[model samples]
Target: MHTRRPFRTLALALGTAGLLISGCSSGSSSSGAASPAQAASVSPSPVPAALKSYYAQHLSWRDCGVSGFQCTTMKAPLDYAKPDGGEIKLAVSRKKATGPGKRIGSLLVNPGGPGGSAIGYLQGYAAIGYPAQVRARYDMVAIDPRGVARSEPVECLTGPQMDVYTQVDQTPDDDAEVTKLSGAFKKFATGCEKRSGEVLPHVSTEETARDMDMLRALLGDEHLNYVGASYGTFLGATYAELFPGRTGRLVLDGAMDPSLSSIELNRDQTAGFETAFQSFAQDCVRKSDCPLGTTSADEAATRLKKLFTELDAKPIPTGESRDLGESLATTGVIAAMYDESAWPQLREALTAADAGDGSGLLALADSYYEREPSGEYANLMYANAAVNCLDLPPAFATPQDVTKALPSFEKASPVFGEGFAWAALNCAYWPVPATGTAHRIEAEGAAPIVVVGTTRDPATPYHWAESLADQLSSGTLLTYEGDGHTAYGRGSDCIDTAINTYLLEGTPPPADKKCS
Candidate 1:
């Protein structure tokens, strides 16, 4: 059926860097006052002297390859438990405010892949696309968390190897195919251990959150002002939980519920994608060019399943040497479901594939894998599995586990069920045992935090935002009654205005505000 993108968000177009710059300034005190009762409820261990030294060190910034963006490297302990043990270099990037008025402090933005490159996101999108008024008031900053791009990345397969990995038939028809898929997963996991064994155990979200605190201190900000999407939302929440007194103006869009086990998360995500596909199918049938017929969503789904079966038997050839197989074709469809703006493109790809041309759909799949025309790939998928595997227990510990859960997963989404069920096995073969566990994050004394949820987000379901908001001690839920992966900066003036007001004025919207 459908394949999932390992990472969360798509890359924004890289734009020309500007020539505006501003200075970093220090400040104290968060927007919301922490109640004494809230403060007393959770007493955290004091920062060790060695760790404090790491946090207090200054960053030496210099002009980067991008015009206005400055880049620097910060050292973080590989293991927080042993501050003096070993260190990892983190890549940091920033674009200072271009202001006509007073500056507000630094504002950090993360485009959530868990593996997504925050530095790339900042220079490519946030620095240029964020609200100008907000940009004028704060230094837009991003850091590539350990084991991600630009920092010391987690390397697994080579481009050609990854190509073969992505093409593996996810819906195995027999024991041999299932064994082959398991082999593929084992090969991938083994590759990560061989290449990145040192960093694999320390790349969990909790460690990344700790790194953010160090970044905040180095940037001289008393509190963190941040925007996180998809997996990044989980990260921002972790920071709030770990550093409640330092929490400030956090916007968590497309949020994830930390309390979910891997099994629940995967099952929920499968259902989410099914919901998104229903929406797409309903809209697709209305168009004359739609290849899946205009009868109904069920009919469209049946037609799609038939197409996938056909591709499984005989893949269609593309302009490039690579052919469009069931796995790639399914991934292409899933990618388009992330943003409705891509629906037209998905339709055209489907029409071409139905007519024997597979280039368009292959291109979409290529983009999802970050596969360059030269057959090169970024480390996104590798890092995605690295962090995801270490953050929580595996969804399936063995093929038997997947077999037992297959029925329930299929019930979640008939079209994507089998594929996702097999895909969840990727983490089961991981070499490193999970270092973290699913738990509630109260961030007891944290300031007002804004959690934005789109009604039908495929990756991070809406109910997750509701759950997270309810879990956090001071979380406020902001609902966008629409479709898409995230809400803010996607053409809703209402959402943009509310978020901008929150970041600039330190006041969030009403606790349960709903925007169209």
Candidate 2:
């Protein structure tokens, strides 16, 4: 596929430290026939050659039992093409089946990020939040994917380097600022190659999907039963594409569209953020503490946009040298879009920003960037970039591509499109070239796959969930008309009950199931 160079773009996404970061990245694809499915009753396939040597070198298992749980490590080839080239160890943990009757097998979990550590999710959330019956009948498992935490990580920049990078003016105007921004991008990319060249090139979602297959075999399961969130949905969809028959009771919440090119993905996401912003705006107008307009949602948006423009020209000073500029302000706003829970906090931040006290907004931005009070960064951004760069090729090749794409992006998301479109360019200058393309994933004959979407989800839009559901031959759309990134575990009892029933009983939710 033809790639275009991207121009400057703004950014935002929370990583492992449980905060958001504003930036962009790039990715690759895989070519291999999935193993044919056998009867639901059968012995596990032999470990793939790629996993055997990997298992020997990197894994060291120990006793880990949290009530009815057993933890272990699973190893696989870093590069599927050359499985033996080297191995990357995945941190695997599982809460074994506590059955009332016949038990199925292990059900793996991934909490998105493309970089969000599944093990972290398993320990922090899923191990407790998942429905009791589902937890009772099946082994709830988690694996940190290659280049993600607990695996061979991909380190890009240090805490201090990231501090500078995050503070860099994202919205470039004059040539000098653009040069500075581009230099930051170059430094971040080069740092990835320099610090993690060995595995950076192999961290694509497709590779991670393949790794899932190997784990399925090693766990002695006949098929893979898994639940994925946010970017995890993309990973699950990719797995379904590659190993259709092996899929079992899969739940892809906060679904991502595999067909959209980088430009389309960024544009759609930009619009999604605007939709979320509109929701927040409408809510804010009704609330007294709203920093923006107290009238219509559009008025609130207009007020916010004007602030963004003003900040672009003259950044407000925080107590620290780093102030709330257009980039950081945008980052704070986008971070709020991820979860409605953050809306009030964002309003406070905006109030602070409006009053020329940018500390609140900076804190929000810092949370998004996952920068702790101590200034250390979790590996989330590094792994996010590594996986993104490997999943698909660059979105832009030159500044002209971004320019050409700007109008369409703006139309898609009047608030966030241009910045996101320009942000897509960050991959253009990646040290490792992208090897993947936007492709359709039609998991024909796969067991019914439950796809969950939140109506006002920020990171992964609801429509993408609808599109992915339509694309997968057996995908069943389960809608949660609510706010948040992923719906299953975010306090939606109905959503959780529906998914839990499916996971435990193997009965898919109704095709058009809607839970408010």
Candidate 2 lDDT score relative to the true structure:
0.74
Candidate 1 lDDT by residue in tens digits, 429-466: 99999988999988898888999999988888899999
Worst 10 residues of 2 by lDDT: 1-10
Give the TM-score comparing model 1 with the true structure, all chains together: 0.93
Residue-wise lDDT of candidate 2 within 1-516, one digit each (tens)?
A: 001111001121243324221121221211112223433322344556645755334333344534434456576776788775776777676666666855677788887776776776676667676776777776777787888777777888888888788767765666787678768778988999999988888888888888888777666666788888878888899987887767878999888898988777777787777788889899999987789978889889889889989998888999986777888788778876777878888888899889898888888777666677888877777887777777777677766687788888788777777677767777878887787889888877677899999898777889999999999888899999987677876778889889988887788898889999
Candidate 1 stretches greater than 4 Å from native: 1-46
Pick the lDDT winner.
1
- lDDT score of residue 516 within candidate 1: 90
RMSD of each: 4.4, 6.8
